[model samples]
Target: MSFRLTELAEADLECIAAYTAKQWGEAQALTYTGQLTHAFRKLGGTPSMPGSRKRDDLAEGCRILAVEKHLIVYRHHAGLTEILRILHQRMDLLLQRLF
Candidate 1:
């Protein structure tokens, strides 16, 4: 299966990088970004892996997978997965309207 990042997901990544850089440092930001990219590849390779959890509130096929302190939200379909957002684990997903 193939995976793609939605525009919002891409924007989320950018914002994450910027925030991490400001709060921590450039190196940490780059490291987290790299981790996120690796997580995306893993999701593409095995989207139904055990650790990923279903999100019924989001939609029929929505799911969330964790990578360290962050969460990767995505929707899976026939031949591809669409990454919807990347958010900090502590953030209230409901307040963000992730559902």
Candidate 2:
């Protein structure tokens, strides 16, 4: 399966990189972003694998994967994985109105 990030997810990643870089450093930001990228690829290849939680409550076929302090919200369908959002663990997901 192939994966793509929604505009919101892309924006979230950009914000994450900027925040991480400001609080830590450029190297740490790169490292964290790399980890997120790796996770996206892994999930795209094996979206239903263990360690990812089913989130049908949010949407049909929805799934959530936690990496570090971030939560990746996605769905796999028609041989494609669509990343819906990348939110901080502390964020209130319901308030975000995640699709």
Candidate 3:
């Protein structure tokens, strides 16, 4: 099945990039973006993985993950999974927790 990332997800990445750029320069931000995108793409095929989350407040139909030090949120619908957002693992992950 094909997958798409939500606009919020894209914007989340941009926010990270901007933050990282201000602190570590654009190169690091771009590099981190690449990693985030890779993880997002890897979300394909498997509807859910061991460290993934399914949030209700955001999309009402979403999935998520806390990989490394970052959080990747997504959703699978009609055979297609779309990433919703990405953020620091330490960033209020309660919303993405498996509770």
Candidate 4:
């Protein structure tokens, strides 16, 4: 499977990387970004695996995961593809819609 990150998601990821660089360090920021990227890839690699996540909705074709206090929301589209959203775990996710 492959993945396509929405523009908003890409921008948010850049913001996250910048924040991590300031709060932690460039090295740590890269690590965090890498980890998140890898996680998203894994999520796309096996559609069945994502459904195991708590609160997942296979019917909705989406799943959520917690990564370093942030919530990663992702949806699998047809053709073994996925889209990702990195958000504050405490936020009202619906308000973050970009599509």
Measured by TM-score, the strongest candidate is: 2
- Candidate 1 residue 97 C-alpha distance from true site, Å: 4.0
TM-score of 3: 0.73
lDDT of each: 0.87, 0.92, 0.72, 0.72
**lDDT by residue for model 3 over 41-64, one digit each (tens)?**
677777686777666665566667
Give the residue spans of candidate 4 off by over 4 A. Answer: 50-59
> Which pairs of residues collide in model 4?
none
Instruction: Mark the regions of model 2 whose C-alpha exceeds 4 Å error after superposition.
Output: none
Best by lDDT: 2
Can you give the lDDT of residue 54 in candidate 2? 94
Residue 19, candidate 2: alpha-carbon lDDT: 98
* Structural similarity to truth (TM-score) of each candidate: 0.88, 0.95, 0.73, 0.80
Judge candidate 1 at residue 55 and give its lDDT. 85
Give the per-residue lDDT digits (tens) of candidate 1, residues 1-99. Answer: 589998889989999999999999999999999999988888888888889999867667889999988899998788787898898899887666543
**Deviation from native of the Cα of residue 39 in model 3, angstroms:** 0.7
lDDT by residue for model 2 (1-99), tens: 589999999999999999999999999999999999999999999998789999887777889999999999999988998999999999987678664
Off by over 4 Å in 1: none
